[model samples]
Target chain A: MEQKKVILIIDDDPDIRSALRVMLESAGFVVGEAANGEEGLKAVQRIQPDAVIIDLMMENVDSGSQVAIKLKEDKYPGPMYMLSSAGDAVRYNIDARELGLAGIFQKPVDPKVFISTLKAKLGVA
Target chain B: MADSSGKYSQSVLSKIIRFFLRDEEGSFPVFLHSLRLEDQLYDFTIVRFSVAFLIIAGSLFAKYILEISQLNHYALIILAIILFFANTINFLIAYPARKKKEKSSAYRFLLIFILHLSIATDFIFLTIALWLVGGVYSPFQTFFIFHVIIASVLFSPLISFAYTIYGYLLFLTLAIVSWKQWLPPIFPIGAVPSDAPPTGKYIITVAVVQGLLFFLTASLTTHLMYFLREGQRQIVRINKDLERLCDQRKGFLQIALHNLRAPISAIAMHLQNLLYGYGGELNDNQKSWVQRSLTRIDELISFLHDLENLSVMENADLLREANEFGLNDLIEKIIEENQDLILSKNHEIKIELPEGKIFILGIQRLIREAILNFLTNAIKYTPPNGKIIVRAYRYSSCVRVEVEDNGIGISKEDIPKLFREFVRLKNQKREGVDTTGSGLGLFIVRQVIESHGGKVFVKSEPGKGSIFGFELPIHIKK
Candidate 1:
């Protein structure tokens, strides 16, 4: 039996977390969900997922971005994905390519495209 | 009273005419000169024709009514011929000289003196003739009042007073001489004997009444004219003060906005670097958090920008510089620039613009900022795979641009305050979107549009789509 690839999803919206979880699970990967950046960080430490999907705006205001910075500074080896609203993407200078992010998706993400992009970034295709 | 050197000087007369026609250099002076000349020609023709008709009719009536022995018929005929010759010579000599030296002050004074002298001669002759016919009971004494009134209204008060004195003296001299039986026994009416002495008391009473009436009318008219001129001066002063205050307010606002720009720009740049991993390589979780912080910084900067614009709008004269541009091109550029965000959500943008160029006058940068704000808000509220349609068309006297989105529309309560600064819907708050925005986007948009003399309107229903539209005037320059 092969070990299933685990991915952590950090977002304040329940709909987004649930949708991401269903998409990753259906793509033959194990998924973990946290309602905030803090919870997401904890889940990352405990589950050590192969990749993480985070929202740019969430509780604690920029906690998700702070978590991403912390993980990178700590030399944590995992792919990161950022999800932002259209306004946020324009207002904030978030370049996924430059930030070592595998991809950045605007909400509400499509289940099929979300899964495909995640799989490709995680080398699970 | 008769100083030979004090007689009306030609130089003084020339100065007066020159004052009336000081400048012939500009278009206004030329127009005025032509108008004056036309008026003078019209007056001359009318006066000459009317006076000539009056003289001819008067002589014909005298010839038919009087008997050969009544009053001295031969002397009356001689006096009439002499008066007619004198008038003809004055008219012929004066008219040509007036035309040649119309703009000369000395000519104007001479013309006025000659007119007054002619009137004085007519009055003296008429008075002598009336005295010969009916002493103080002559009906022609009423005509003396006309001369008094004309002198008071047209001449300065000093000149009018002098004319009044001269008239009183003349009346007194005629009355005394006729009463003493020193003048000829001339009478036209059979009712009055030629030996009857003129009534001194009646003549003096008439002169006093005429002088009083002339002074009263002249003084009252001058007072009214002065009052109106002063009122106009006060109104002009008030308008100048208001303009000065408005200019000062604009100057202060410009200085304040210029000072705020540097600080806001610095903050935004620093935040941008942090979000982009200029500090260090961000792990999966760190990158997401930093990006969130950058959004909040951007929001704050946008709010500052709005405040600066609102200040600019206070001074109407310092409004944004407008230039003509193609509306379609501007919209296309904004859409293309934000393509990544639209693509990320799988949202489709549909642009429905007129086929030809929709030329509009606006500040390109401000218009772009306003449109970008609208598009961002549309995409922010819309759900995944939602559609945004931007339409542009020319309305009467204005151009209308609308952005419609089929997304989670604004609630009824939030719609009213959607354009207010720092006002975000409760739902956006519930989503834990803690972007550092000062929430001044819509407010800025409204201010910018209004500064251009345009208007912005929004329509939204919760759970339905939202439509935002703005109209700009077609001709904004003037």
Candidate 2:
């Protein structure tokens, strides 16, 4: 039997963290959650999940994106994705690919697309 | 278009004109000459020549009253004819100048040369006429004082000094040459008695005194104009500095407002997930509360959006990107955005646009935001099954856009307060309408329109429809 892949969700909003946890769990993957960027970094070190999803904005402005950079520098092997609800990605002139992000999802994330992308990132299929 | 060789010829022609007019010889005592002086110089010349005409005509009568020579009479007549021709040329130059407010320096210099040339030539002819009348003893020599004064007021001290030197040398030479018997005796009246004061002594004395006066007048007038010009330049610089500060502050405020949107957006997203059951099942009561919170959060987000828009509209950098875009395209987009709301209310929305596209130069995003505000207001106020109409048409030099609605109309007194920031009418929160609004909608609309050099107008009466619109200058396609 294969071990179920784990994913980490980093966001300041408790409701969003709980929602992501439930969605990922129902999709047959284990999920870990952190309330802020600081805790998110610690959680990534301890759990070393297959994929990481972080909010663009958290306790501090752009904290999530900054943490992703820090994680990449730390050589975290998990793929990172960015979630934002601050209008469009183009509005901020950010290219996820150039930032070492696997992808960006606008919230509220569509369940079908979010789950599928997560599966691809985890290579579950 | 003409190539470099053509431009080269143009520049060469300008140089020749400048040299002949002696314009390139003088540096201004102040920056006054750097400003557009074509109109000012032209007007001054017209007035000066007209006065010269009057002086010559008046002197003719004076000479006759005193019974002077017929030779003096012919000299005065010839001088008046030359001055009249100068005034006519001055008048012709004004036509092209009035048509084009900003002339190229070359064209302006040409016009300036023609004007100065006419006046300068008239002065020379007048001096000869004076010498021919009485050599050193011509009573009309007083006119030299007036010429020096006018020239000093209109041009730089150097030009005035040049004019003074030219007049003094020519007058002195005429007297000396006549005294030496090298030219005909310029005694238009009877010859001076042989016993009278020596003509050479009188001529030299008069020339020295007149030249001193010319130099004094030029120095004084130029100094006064210099002080006046420096004061004007200082005021212009201060005004520019203040405008720059305003733009900087607007930019800071816009960035802060956009930053505020990020957290609010995250809050709204979390609330939406809760309402949609992404975080497991919720009771009907819990779901209703979450939906209400989401609606309020959305309102805050929109208010921040309006604030960002207001700041951007005030930004000077954004104004430079204004480009020509179709009026019909903007109106159609606004209608399409509100299609759902329009259908929900069952409103009969009609669009009246020009036969073809009407192009106007503006920041498309700002203009679109303004029209959207008006459409949103119309949809918000109009009751179920009500009528809404959007119209765009050319109005003289501008394109007029209008949004009309048969909704709960505003009173006469309230109309004036409509565009004021954070102004929501008392009676606007009627039943069966989503009254949640930032109140900055109309204010933003007015700011955007006015920034584009346009005007906003509103017309309404209680229980009748409201008509809200703006007019923007049309862009004539190249």
Candidate 3:
């Protein structure tokens, strides 16, 4: 038996958070949730999640991306992905590698693609 | 006149000043007077200073070269210096009043009044100088016309008209006094005390002609100013209306897209859940329909994103903040970050960066967006296992970046159709490729590159692969 990978989902919208949680949980991953970037940071420290998905436009523009930068500065060793509502605008304004984001998922992300990427990266069956 | 700034803004004098403050008329009760028209007063001071220079030069020329004993060189030089000092002091004091970010209407009223007073006082000085020289018969008596014209241009027509009448009255008085020989030997320039004075009829005739000339200049200039101001106000009104309409359209677009995006995203998520068996098991037919709807929703999301990018690219603030960044470093970072995307397409990306760092001056985010557009576009249009060669190096004086891809190419004719906004291609939509182009992606790319003093270039044929690139002038650090 293998341990399930823990993923933290940070978003302002409860619906979006819940949707991500359902998709993650159903895929045999443990899902943790936070309402904002600050809480997400604390949650990452506490949960020590294997992966994190942050909504780029939570509370303010680029707050989620800024949080990712902070997490990377704090030397958190985990894969991070950003969910963007403004796909190209967010992509252009930020350097994904500078923020240490593994990838960006567009809003209403494809569940299969997201889950598969996480599963493949974590090397979990 | 002694009213507080509040009461003074509502005063009739202030109303008239406000009316003429802005060259272009706008809504009344608007905050802040234009600093532009106020700047014109500085122009007037320049002219006044030039006149002072001319006065000093002329008097010196008359004394030393022309050897005119009758002209009082001392008094003329003194007056010239006085004009210089007075203008300099007034400029230094009043210059700050117009430059404030927020202009009180009362402050503006004071500015106009001060300007009006200065021009009016100039006429009085001219009158005194004329009286000393020969009164109505003075050579510089005609100089009053210049002041009349200046007043007509800087102040309202009614004020100019009043000044014109005042000059005519002053002329009448001078003529009467000259006829009575009140100052027969005017400052050694006029007739000597022993010589006989001119007749009343002669004085009156000369004065009448001079007065008519004065009135003619004032009336014509004032009339011309009136028509020009009316035209300016009309154009300004039209421009304001157009601007308001454009802002409203942009606001509506932003709001409509934002409102549409949230609900559509929520719907897509729900649909995704159902398709993934969150609701229950679905038949094959249901699965196909759900996939189709999901694809459509994704396209809608992409279109909205493109639209937002369009608005963001046009933002003035984004264009204003320029930075110098290493071209190679940015390219390397972009490639590193987009490795997943490239790998997903099974495309082989070959990067050719200059050995040394290449610096370019531009809005960094906009430049990045443009470069990203070219890369993603190449990836999107190219078939799987296609080869993408991205090169950045010095080309002549400019640093050029090229994205060459071996994929389905566009004809020379279809090339131009690629960058236009919202124009979908008929021939380019291949069987396997997902072409969810808003047609704005390339348009945005062009805009961003062009704004950075760069030109985008593309080389391709219908069968062969495409090469898309741009050249930006190299930025050298001082």
Instruction: Superpose all Cα atoms of candidate 3 onto the true structure and report the RMSD in Å to 1 decimal.
Output: 8.8
Model 1, C-alpha of A60: deviation from truth (Å): 41
Global lDDT of model 1: 0.64
User: Whose lDDT is greatest here?
Assistant: 3
Local distance difference test scores for all models: 0.64, 0.72, 0.78
Q: Which regions of candidate 3 deviate over 4 angstroms?
A: A13-48, A66-75, A87-92, A108-113, B1-37, B53-82, B91-110, B128-143, B173-198, B209-248, B266-295, B318-320, B395-398, B416-418, B473-478
- Of candidate 2 chain B, the 10-residue stretch with the lowest lDDT total is B23-32
TM-score of chain A of each: 0.89, 0.93, 0.94
What is candidate 2's CA lDDT for residue B330?
71
Docking quality category of candidate 1 according to DockQ thresholds: incorrect
Clashes of 3: 0
Q: Give model 2's DockQ, 2 decimals.
A: 0.10
Q: Name the better of 2 and 3 by TM-score.
A: 3
TM-score of chain B of 3: 0.74
List TM-scores of chain B, every candidate: 0.46, 0.61, 0.74
Instruction: Spell out the clash pairs found in candidate 2.
Output: none
Give the alpha carbon lDDT tens digit for every residue of B195-214 in model 3: 24558887868877888898
